[model samples]
Target chain A: MDAVAAEWWKLRSVRSTYWTLSAAAAVFVFVLLLAFQMAHIWDGLSVERRADFTLRPLQELGGWAAALCLAVLGVLSVTSEYRSGMIRTTLTVVPRRGRVLAAKAAVVGTVALVAGEAVSIGSFLGTRLVVGDRPFPDQGASIAHDLPDFAIVGASVAVFALLGMSLGVLLRSTAGALVSVVFLWHVLPLLVFQLPEPWNERVGSVMPGALPGQIAGRSADSSIYGDLLPPGAAAAVMLAYALVPLMLAGFALSRRDA
Target chain B: MCGGPSRTTVDRMIEVRELTKRYGATTAVDRLSFTVRPGTVTGFLGPNGAGKTTSMRILLGLDAATSGEALVNGGGYAALRRPMREVGALLDAGAVHGGRRAFDHLGWLARSNGIGARRVAEVLEQVGLAGVARKRVGGFSLGMRQRLGIAAALLGDPGVLMFDEPVNGLDPDGVRWIRELMRSLAADGRTVLVSSHLMTEMELTADRLIIIGRGRLIADTSVRELADRFRRGVLVRTPRPAALTAVLAAAGGSVESMPGGALTVTGMDVAVIGDRAAARGIPLYEVTPHSASLEEAYMELTAGSTEFGAVAS
Candidate 1:
């Protein structure tokens, strides 16, 4: 745990991570406003429904933010080390490569969760002020409020970040890991959904992005992910996706040289 | 028996014994063994592809040996709880994060090792990189990058240190500074093992040398002892080769003729060569002691035994 705390300090001390999180915040706010503007285009029943209605759209926006910010957070967190050859330096300080990998994984996930949640809440509130309380529920009654959505999406962001981190660790090269996770987490899942019906249903449940959607709940397109996985199932899948690379990387770390 | 030097001094002796590394059919290191003691610079000497880098990597736990082991503070580098505090090594100056600022790069290493954040600044200054500490490492010249690497190695202030080819690309002044740095580090009772191909450079820096060729130990000796035992004969040049030759013949000395009216004299000292020349009134142009350079002697000794000669490397 001391090693883990040390790893955390190293991660947070870097400027690249702050810039990446800031980018995510800026993008999340921009997209939240865009989602709020789109809410006006849809025909709704009542002002009350409209106020309550923004929750879904905001949730969706937050989910997408969680999903995409991973591309930045995950790649930058681990692959940036590779790009700078800082991983070797990191390994030198903590030669138990397994412990180092775990420390990095834990650090990346926890930071992403916190950063992702902060960015989501800031963007949600900033956009709420711009979009008006009348339409998006300044009522502040339901857990569907910005705070809960922030928690859920924060978890989703953490999942994606860990997923990306796992891929980064599995593939030591920067370009290779980034390209692989982008394809596996983003492109491959899209390609998999377009496949034959049962295949899409089956594969979507296990894909990395599926974890985020399961946590946030699927849209009308829920069928696209084989009868929307329960939050528990999604969490399990997320843990699985994150842990496989971690374990493989750990084994490789121990078996092979640093 | 190979407890090495870590036991005696404040330094943790890095002991590599019977360490062998192989890649498929190619045997890279063959039962190589040596001890790097603290309080003196131990030079890891070898020609190109002589497995100096491989051996260092194995010792640092960056690469696994095919057999045997390397111990840092009585355990493998990977087993150490605080590896940087136990063993700090720079296998290559180029093995660094070029995109990171020098201070940030070293800072991360410091953080991981549980060292104080202040050590980063101190080490950066120690390596003369305080001015460029915030600059991107990619922009540094090879010498500056070497300094950054040294800074990283020194971040934890560990007792054991290893560097391979640390002077690969440096101005003469930078090279001299590194030599002095190694000596000073050793003077502080830290175990410092440095590797270089240049014997002259090692001659100035290393208190003792571990010379290897073809992944095998050639000699583990000191500079003066090497010079004495190698027995490279004295050189006596003369403007009158025939006169010197006859004088050598009468004096029970052997003189070998050279193409440029020179004589390679054996079985005599420079003073004797000078006295003989003076007595015969033969003008002596040069009477220099031509001790075989450790590099040349090393080459001659390993001439038939190198693993990387006459092969496309």
Candidate 2:
């Protein structure tokens, strides 16, 4: 309990925590606002069609925006500590490596989850104001969608931040951790999607992105990916990617001399 | 020897037994043992890379010991239920969040082990950091940061305090302040362990000294004893050197004849030598007492075992 309190105090005391979360919130709302404007866009389309347009698509965009929020939160939670060299001090105080890591993941994960839910619900309600009495997207077709569950968002952000923690500990360089996180969490997932055949598609299908799609649901015109496994499985894989390194780093910290 | 690390009582603090640390094939601290008693300033003296820092880190549980043990209150540092209140240490002055304010940094540390925010302010004042309590530590100079580190260590008002290279980059005034601070802390009946390569500073500040070289213990004794063991004989220069030598040698004093017609007298009282020269009709040009310092004595002691070799004199 004391360790958790200490970790929370440390988390709240830093400007970087608030700054990164605010930036994420601003980006999220801004992107959703843009999504709204796009839904109601009247520049090119016919006047009749423009008036007939629905705001349901903005809801899908909201999930993407939330993912971006997690990325920022995840990076800041771990990378900021590495940059300032506070990790050593933190480890010195706590001494329990696994507990420290768990406390950090819990705090950052909770914050990210709350923020993600706000983006989901805020964009869902806010976008509804611009488009009224519209038919929603298909329920079954958007196989991997996440429906703004605080649990899902919390899990996703927790995993991402955990991976960042491992990278910070292993590399001991903020720049290197940041680059590797950006590459491994975001770019690698994208590259996996590009691989030829069913294997590439299979791997990309279960990546971190797999969860958000389930909540957003598919638009009426989209093809059904109903064959895909549930978001829970993909979420598990994403978590595994984060947990393995975290475990390795914790063991190494205990065994090695600082 | 127990299932977990132990915590020693404040009155009977640390016992380090054969503590060793190595990085791969290169040993940083080798089979070193020393006890730091309560209510005394024990100086940890060694040149750079002689394992002073490594030994401190091992004691703090920041580094795993290669072999042996360092017990605080008769237990390992990490095993203590409340380490901060038992043993407070400052290994690095700059181990703080750059973006966070100083008080906030201390606040979190205070919150740990059930300490309060009010104690943080008190500690800040104790270290002369009250004026900059709200300032971001990133903007603080090295000296200010050192003060802040001291504040962190003093926050819990622990029994045993360990400072590694406390006066490294401090200016002369800062150094003096630290010496006085250390003395004051020890005066309050706290165990203060200070490490430094500056032997002269340690000479005046420390009550007892533990000297290390090549990651091993060299000498652990009182400052007075160290200077006494390595004290050179009384130096005397005289025009009638033969007369002084004959007179001093007649009194059972070993005499070394130096150039410039000077005579060095050993194993005899200096005042007696002066009186003997006067009585023997010897006209003495000069007779001076040569007081040996801890730095000079340390140089003589560790001349052979300095692992990385001494810096050019």
DockQ of candidates 1 onward, in order?
0.47, 0.61
Q: Which stretches of candidate 2 lie over 4 Å from their true place?
A: A42-57, A134-155, A214-227, A238-242, B1-12, B278-286, B307-313
The C-alpha TM-scores of every prediction are 0.86, 0.89
Top lDDT model: 1
How high is the lDDT of residue A156 in model 1? 67
What does candidate 1's lDDT look like per residue over B239-268, in tens digits?
778878998878988778767777788788
How many Å off is the CA of A88 in candidate 1? 2.5
User: What does candidate 2's lDDT look like per residue over B135-156, in tens digits?
Assistant: 9899999999999988888877
lDDT of 1 at B45: 86
**What residue pairs are clashing in model 1?**
A51-A135, A84-B97, B6-B13
Q: Residues A49-135, candidate 1, lDDT per residue (tens digit)?
A: 565454445544654565566556776677776666566666767777878778878888787877777766656665555555444
Chain B alone, TM-score of each model?
A: 0.85, 0.92
